[model samples]
Target: MAFRRDPKTPAMTTDLPQHVFRLRVRYDECDPMGLVHHSNYLRYFEIGRTEFLRSSGGRYREVEEAGLYVVVVHIDCRYRASARYDDEIDIVTRIAKITAAKIIHEYEIRRGDEVLVQATVTLAVIDKTGRLQRVPEALLT
Candidate 1:
């Protein structure tokens, strides 16, 4: 898996190719204790991945229009810390692996210098009829 610290770091520029997106924890997304709800972290990860794809020159709708649909096949997350409301978070995502019909993405949710969550998600491309299909070359490049 490609892992980059920051976009400008030499290791990031030469060794890894990943996307990073920033988000703010909203008051409405938190529980009464002021910590972000567990479920909402998944939503945040999704948004981060979507934005990563967008920056890579593709969008979910466009992929669907091309007869391809990505379905989440697996998701694993570990919460290491807590993020309170109004915290500025960084969602870092990278392509962990790619196969004929599947892609794996790894994510890290950080509040400043502290990592709050780490997740790995796997998605498979399928046709409308539910037959597995290879990811489009256009999408990869």
Candidate 2:
């Protein structure tokens, strides 16, 4: 899907369209060591994706209502650093590529200027019967 800018929102221009979702690491999302749990980074990526879609004037619910579902087929996450509880971080998400039935997204979890984690995720579209389906053309733009 192409990123659409909202006129009222402040924008950042980049080579690849991206959305930055910022949040603080909550206590419940952290481990006993006060560091964010590894699993929580995936959740952050999901939030980033959701916000990215919303900001681009799209919604997952709308896709589902159209009888199409996007399911994650692959994910590759690399952790470079640890984030402590209460740390404010930004999850940068971009659409890396799109195919007939698959969309690839790249993400970076950054605490200020330091990238704590990077990931790539692939999602495939499917119909209600769970059969693979090509992504709708309307959703591409």
Residue pairs clashing, model 1 = none
Model 2, TM vs. native:
0.88
Instruction: Tell me, by lDDT, which candidate is best.
Output: 2
lDDT of each: 0.83, 0.87
Query: Could you tell me which 10 consecutive residues in candidate 1 have the lowest summed lDDT?
Result: 7-16
Question: To one decimal, what is the Cα RMSD in angstroms of model 2 from the true structure?
Answer: 6.7
- Per-candidate TM-scores read 0.86, 0.88
- Those runs of model 1 whose alpha carbons end farther than 4 Å from true positions after fitting are 1-16
lDDT, model 2, position 72: 93
- For candidate 1, write residues 14-127 as lDDT tens digits: 233588899999999999999999999889888988988889787889889898899999999999999899999999988876666777889999988899999999989999
lDDT of each residue in 1-141, candidate 2, tens digit only? 344444554331234678999999999999999999999999998999899988878889999999999999999999999999999999999987666688788999999999999999999999999999987754566
